[model samples]
Target chain A: METPLSRTDRTRLGRHAERAGTTRSDLDAVLDQGMVCHLGVVVNGSPRVIPTGYGRIGGTLYLHGSTGASSLAASPSQEVCVTVTHLDGVVLARSVFNHSLNYRSAIIYGVPRPVTDPDEKLAGLRAITERLAPGQWDHARLPTRKELAATTVLALPLTEASVKVRQGPPIDEDEDYALDLWAGVLPVRQVLDAPEPDPRLPPGVPVPPHIARRATPTS
Target chain B: METPLSRTDRTRLGRHAERAGTTRSDLDAVLDQGMVCHLGVVVNGSPRVIPTGYGRIGGTLYLHGSTGASSLAASPSQEVCVTVTHLDGVVLARSVFNHSLNYRSAIIYGVPRPVTDPDEKLAGLRAITERLAPGQWDHARLPTRKELAATTVLALPLTEASVKVRQGPPIDEDEDYALDLWAGVLPVRQVLDAPEPDPRLPPGVPVPPHIARRATPTS
Candidate 1:
């Protein structure tokens, strides 16, 4: 059986307790589907949030940044919070006060360890690259030694994480349902358009199947 | 002349300084376009990040949440960071090291003040509601006084904010450009699908023009 997500005092849901996700898969699903995560760390006694790309390998989450980035530099020394949120829709209710969003969010709290092992570093980088563009790792030139040295990868275990999901139509108050108002969900989704080839491309190189396949619109 | 954005010691860009956006309008544009923002606050000496909805009126940003929320409750006492990010495309380069994302992001840092004035509170709630649904405030029933008392609205100034925007195609190294690989941007966007009316809607109310107008896909 898969291990369940940890529910410590910090991860415990207070307001909408019903929306909290229980199992480990719930956390993974939210992390895997997201393209970017907002990483939070305290610097000079002030909170700083940075939006950056991330990848996950099993229970370990990998985040890469320029070694010179101040936020990344300050992250390893203290506990950090990484949040991945997907806005699914807007919930419109009969009253303005009832307006809420349909979203799935995962929050992980941990002190990340700077990845130093060269082999693991490569694996982490591969996970990050493949997460953004699948099948491109083998097709493109891999990172060189100099390039790897300039990058910093940090790994945070997914031991302390919580997932919250809200979906479907708005729930208006019992009396307010009688009101003459249009109330429903405006479903929102991220889609890919046709790929724009580089202006410098020399003649006949066609768009690869991996990239082209994703460009097809669902709607 | 339009006022430029304040550049504090913290807001100064260190890496990729060229991507920094100048002027107050640049900051406004980034904040205005986004539907959600990640709020960062230090709670009990550890950083906690929460994804929440926000709206900007002039130079002040308003964020609302349940009065019981721990993140929102802790925000007003100390400095908080709010970040809004829009992912434009996947910048696929010839080498994995050169791959990047085309995105626009704004980071705001300030000590939020809890709005206590009843008139300003209602206006702040309207701004937050209108930001998500343009015309819903007038269409829906306004918040009751009892409901207003249960919500918390925190206002943070846009005085210390920075915007970073990366657009267009990826830039590869001179030598890597000769490689036989597909490298370009896979443009991404959030779109609305057909509205799903509430099952309990009392039959004859038609979808408003404001909501219907947004459902038409641009692509």
Candidate 2:
């Protein structure tokens, strides 16, 4: 339902602008496919990028951290960037200059606001938990009132975002294509291997169906 | 030969200081394990994070982009943060508050210097190429003089960096451990699927061993 607008002055692509997607759905696809994002925030007059899990509900992306995390606590006041990327393949060309990676990525720039309302905070936490492992929120014990109070959730609007995607085989110069060389795409995949149960688990606890089904390729 | 010193004022870990590694080897391991890095820079008085490939040789890391790329060109004078992250697993705990991700990440902060010397420029380009596809750099045709001139390579010192690693099962509160719930780690792996040769490649061209070997787990 959220149609992303054209690039604004701040979020415009600087190079290879053709790869930038024109629709907001493209941004949603990239964000939904990724499990983790690199959050860039300024600290002590410099930039710090932290890798963490995030969730998107409609037009807002939610990121939560410990209340004690100075970076997240400071993020509300300063502009921040959240980037999610999926490496699809390695583009091997006949010439080194033409080599590239096939990837889909979304970078969101916004000034996040702290989610102080208890209802929104809980919903945001559910979104994040379900993003990492679907159905786990219902299967596992929910957060307690005290736990919710200790967490800090930041909501970033997707209004200012860019989605760039590149795929398929390498595009080399016409002359280079005649060369006798092995050139193609090597597909990359992120998969969840067999689940490992905790050493302290009671003898008969079974792995839930939701977790078991994830042993396949993700994207 | 590079022995990383103790945390300095710049590289000091602000949160979860216990998870930060103290040795330089830790930084090297994180760098070598990753192919893509999120580069964070300040543009128009706000943070912008871009994802790109990088390579490391000894104490320096090299990044390349089109000479016209505003973000890379603007990075030489201002402070930039290059972060490489590997998502290892999903840590599901009995309590939602205790859920975490097992990951290894390195964040390097420095002012990148433009590599103008031809020799270092070529070498840096080789490092970047080989980092993505190991033997393809040697097998493929090297960049021409014109291509080299059009590219911009920047070298960021590895002296100021922070490495954070989190692994194993979630550590829930002692009382919460008594709950009857399934909890453990779901390992994440990045793997290469079989190569898809370019449709236009000559029939006799064979898949190189360098690429065939990557079908296994990357890290």
Candidate 3:
């Protein structure tokens, strides 16, 4: 059986407790499905939230950036928060106060450790690359020594994370439901369009199957 | 002429300086195009990033949440970072190290002030609602006195902000481009699906024009 997520005071949900997801699977689902995450770190005594790519393998989340990036440089010594959110839909209600968004969000809190071990760094980089493009790690040329040296990878354990999901229709006041107004959900989705080959790319190089599969309509 | 965005040491980009946007229009475009934002605030000496909905009006950005929310309650006294990111596509390169994402992101840092003036509070709430669902504030029942009191609205000025955009194909090494591998961009987009009327909603109340317009394909 999969383990339940550890609930510290920080991970506990105080409001809308019903929206909290307690399983490790919940956290993984939210993290895996997202292509990018907002990384929050305190710099110069103020919070700085940055949108960056991220990856997850088992219980650890991996983030990589240029070694000279200020946010990555300042993160190792302090507690940082990483959040992934998927906006599912916009809930329209009979009342303005009742309108809401259907979304799945995961927040992870921990002090990250810089990955220095060669084997682990390679694995972390692979995970990050694969997360961004599933088959590209094997298809593309692997990073050379100098490229790896220029990158900084940080591993954050998923021991302290929380997932919250809000879905379904808006919960309007009982009286408002009787009003002669329309109410519903406008679903939102992320879709991949046709691939545009690089202008510099040589002629007759077809798009790979892995990338083509994403453009196919699932529904 | 539009006022150029203020440049402070914190807002300055050390790496990829060419990607930084200096005009106020750039910041507004990024903010207005996104439906949700990641809010970062420090709580208990640790950074906390929450995925929340926000609205922008001129020089002020407004965010609303239940008064009981811990993140909202702790944010007014300290500096917070709000980031909005729209992923345009995934850049495929000949090498793993050169892969990147095409995106536009805006980051705003400021100390938020609670909106206490009754007119401003209502206006803030209206902006928040309108942002989530355009034409919603006018169609839905306005918040009553008790509902307004139950909500907390925080307004952050757009004085300290930055915008960054990365677009086009990956910048691969000169030699790697000659390899016979597919290199391109797989575009990513947020699209709206058909509206799902609330099951509890009474029949014969048609989907409003505002909501219907979103479901129509833009491209």
Give the clashing pairs for model 1: none
Provide the RMSD of all predictions against the true structure, rounded to 1 decimal. Answer: 0.9, 1.9, 1.0
Q: Give me candidate 1's interface root-mean-square deviation.
A: 0.9
Question: Lowest-lDDT window of 10 residues in candidate 1 chain B?
Answer: B210-219
Error of 2 at A159 (Å): 0.5
| Fnat measured on candidate 2 | 0.84
Per-residue lDDT tens digits for candidate 2, residues A1-219, read 758645787568877788988678999889888889999888776777888889989888999998988789889878999999999999999999999999999989999999989889988999899999888888888888888888999999888888898999999999998898999999988888888998888999999999888887444
**Candidate 1, residue A93: lDDT:** 93
Two-way lDDT contest, 1 vs 2, winner: 1
Q: Please give, for residues B18-101, the per-residue lDDT of candidate 2 as tens digits.
A: 889777899999999888999999877778888999999888999999988888888887899999999999998888888889
C-alpha lDDT of residue A36 in model 3: 96
Write down the DockQ of candidate 1.
Answer: 0.87
Residue-by-residue lDDT tens digits, candidate 1, B1-219:
776888888899998889999888999999888889999999999999999999989989999998988889888769999999999999889999998999999999999999999998998998899989989999999989899999999999889999999999889999999899889999988888888899999788899999988784664
lDDT of 3 by residue, B1-219 (tens): 987898999899898999999988999999998999999999988999998889888999999999999999999878999999999999999999999999999999999999999999998888888888999898999999999999999999998999999999989999997788999999999989999999998778899999899884755
> Candidate 3's residue-wise lDDT over A184-217, tens digit each?
9999999888999999988889999998888848
How do the residues A1-219 of candidate 1 rate in per-residue lDDT, one tens digit apiece? 878999898999988999999888999999899889999999999999999999999999999999999999998868999999999998989999899999999999999999999999999999999888888888889999999999999999999999999998999999999887899999999888898998888788899999899885564
Using Cα atoms with residue i matched to residue i, what is each candidate's TM-score against the true structure? Answer: 0.99, 0.97, 0.99
DockQ each candidate and list the results: 0.87, 0.73, 0.85
Give TM-scores of chain A for all candidates. 0.98, 0.95, 0.98
Better of 1 and 3 by DockQ: 1
